[model samples]
Target: MENSAGCSVSLWQKIVSFLLVIFPILDIYSVGIKGIGIGSIILCFILIGMGIRFLTLNRSIKLNPYYGFFLYGLCISLLTVLIHNDFSITAVAIRMTYFLFYTLLIFLPSSYDFDIHFAEQIYLKIGMAAGAFLILQYFSFWGLRYNLIGLIPGLPLNYAIEDYVEWMDAYNNMYTIMFRPTSFFPEPAAFTQYMAPLLILVLFTNVGEKKKLLKAAFISIVMILSTSTNGIVFSLFIWILYFVYINHDSLKNRRFPIFLVPLFLFAIVFAILILFTDNTISDYTVQQFEGLFSKNQSSSAYLRIMRGFDIYRQLNFFENILGIGLGTYKSYYATGVLTVYDGETEYMNSLSYLFVSTGVIGVLLFIYSLFYNVPRRSMASHALAFLILLSFFSSSLFNSPTYALSYLFLLHLDSIKNSGD
Candidate 1:
């Protein structure tokens, strides 16, 4: 009837499950829904779980190494909050969750393979549902607007969007009213980040689940259609690596670099064909790649990172060592103490975001929290390796609360076993 050593329920498990499953959908950050303090909510649930675990289960606090990693982050975050009293409470809450994560509950004896599968299934379901819901809103011909000039979310709202993104459209109302299916997420990037782990879930399935795989592919493609190229590009790269590694037996024995060689050649050829078929995409890709080389030449993303570099230079050695502190960028910008050479727009590259916000030490702590929690023995080693590589280069350490979600997914898959050593 229950799971958790001899079928006794561990409340910690439930509390964490609630967070991972519900948080993405709730997306507390969308409208800056402040008040009640995010920290308060987390603390309340944490206390409840611990109390129940202690009273009912007699659970032991095993000396997990990852605890130190989280404690470090918690220390950094608290220190940041102390120094920057006006820092974002929400950001602090997000960091806190990472230091103390969902993995702890899974480490308990009661956690099983099914729990892993169940958690992953819920995540995929959410992504698919969000994808379907938003795509339906984009069908303008159906005349599905709310109050005539309908919101893409199909909701009746006074204005279509809060702000206009020049990348999408100049008119704010059109951006909002004409649906680009960002789904339950705030934007495509956020949606991509959420889907990243699901991709891993797909590859790591110990058994067949082809139908779910198809859904994941469809949702992923829909996200790309909304014009989020970076996340999807990197995600597919990771998926390719995952596919190649899983079929290692064939890779080693075959003359083909297993299937990767053909796949790579196919992608290049398809890209060439695409260049002939569609100038817009071809031109954009050429520009994005070419921009990487030019001093000021590159997509807005390259510029953002460059700008971050400019800001990083301005950070004093002490700030460099310890980091500027979480959520400190806005304050620094407002005070005219910092600058992003490329400037920040919604699609800003995340590299500079890390330095400007946390500085070096904070960055290290962030990395430690992820790599450190890796399971003692993980069969999906290549998959785990690919995720870490993809996450850092392609994403901001903090943007979209990715700092935590990325870490959570990686650690769960990284968890090692007694023989893994």
Candidate 2:
């Protein structure tokens, strides 16, 4: 019986590890009838396993460095409810579960001695596979499109391709029309959010420098195919910052200059191909850049920033200071605000969403929570955090358990290195 139980636990770990590996690709499909995403499902499993271990073995789970942050978020959740005097038990329960599950996943690896390298290998492999799929997509080949709906009758995965985007000039005129390759996500930006940290991990791993550059180049192409300005922008930004900051030590060698020749040549060739064969990409990129200062912004930028002042004006003094309420932003408040803006969408970015839900205090506490728990080990870890910070400008990463935990995991991995030093 003892042996059997140990085997069962080991098998469970392996299963969880496998799920972690494919989590990014699995984002395309729901896990069950309830349509909970694979990310949440993975966390649910982790939470269950941890609970079992704790109850059965009487083992205590070690606290993570960010426990206070988690507690702070919890306090804000409940405090907002109390202040607003409007409480839904179901809403409170759901919100708490989200926080608890995230906290559990963030601390699981360290507590259970989870195989970090195994998970990273899985992420990198899936990333490469996703890149390959995007390449095929560019050639008009498809994967996991509308067909996934048939697999789950009541819950359709049709949302993955429900929306279409076209590249437009600065004047809002359509310049190039194509179905953006989502790869295995509902949108191309999701791929970027999933891949960016993994790309950083691959580069920083003890792999050959040549292999690293090759992997980077391949992922860069996929990001270009994603056609998401956020994807392209963050990829280039992190790649440059990583090399300049983290990889600088590797550059102080005799062969470093020799390595640059091929890199320069490759860039030249890639640019020439895009310029001649697909000038549409070049024109689209130029328009996006020019739109920054032009009278009319690109459609994407316009959607992101068009109503910034209008939204800011909607926040009253008390709401701005203490926040209206935790989940109230999405429920009662944000909906009304969106209706006021002629049906403009909320959560255009993380900052705005944070302001709406948590208000000024919540946002400040959240930022402090992130940095307060950050393991400031080496320059590489700092660079990793900086990359995550850059990503925050584009989307609400913390709200997603997977992205939040992944960011924490990377920081923890660097902290391990720091301890060894």
Best of the candidates, TM-score:
2
| Model 1 worst lDDT window (10 residues) | 149-158
Model 2 CA deviation exceeding 4 Å by range: 1-12, 31-35, 54-65, 83-93, 111-113, 141-155, 158-176, 207-210, 246-248, 254-281, 288-298, 305-313, 331-342, 378-380, 415-421
For residues 1-421, what per-residue lDDT tens digits would candidate 2 score against the true structure? 1121122235555556656556545544555434356556666766677677767776766654467555655676677677656555467557667666666666654424345545555667788987787666555523332221102223334233322222112112322343455666656677777777766665555344457767876777677666676666666666676556544455565555634533463465348437533666656655654554464643554445444334655777886776544455555443354343435554546666566666777677766656655666544455566666666665656556446546555645652342112
lDDT of 1 by residue, 1-421 (tens): 2531234333545445545555544433224233222433553465455556565776667665456544554565577677767667676675456434444433332342124434555666676766676555445423544311112343221122333233234333445433334555545556666666666555554344447445545655555544455544655665576556546544455664534543554365335435433455445544554555566544654563466667778888887776665444666666677665644622234555555556676566555655555654564544554565455554553433344444455556543221112
Which predicted model would earn the best lDDT? 2
Residue 410 local lDDT, model 2? 61
- Each model's backbone clash number: 13, 0
How many times do residue backbones clash in model 1?
Answer: 13
**Each model's lDDT:** 0.50, 0.56
lDDT (C-alpha) at residue 405 in model 2: 40
Off by over 4 Å in 1: 1-19, 28-32, 35-47, 62-114, 133-180, 210-216, 252-298, 327-337, 343-351, 356-359, 379-389, 397-403, 414-421
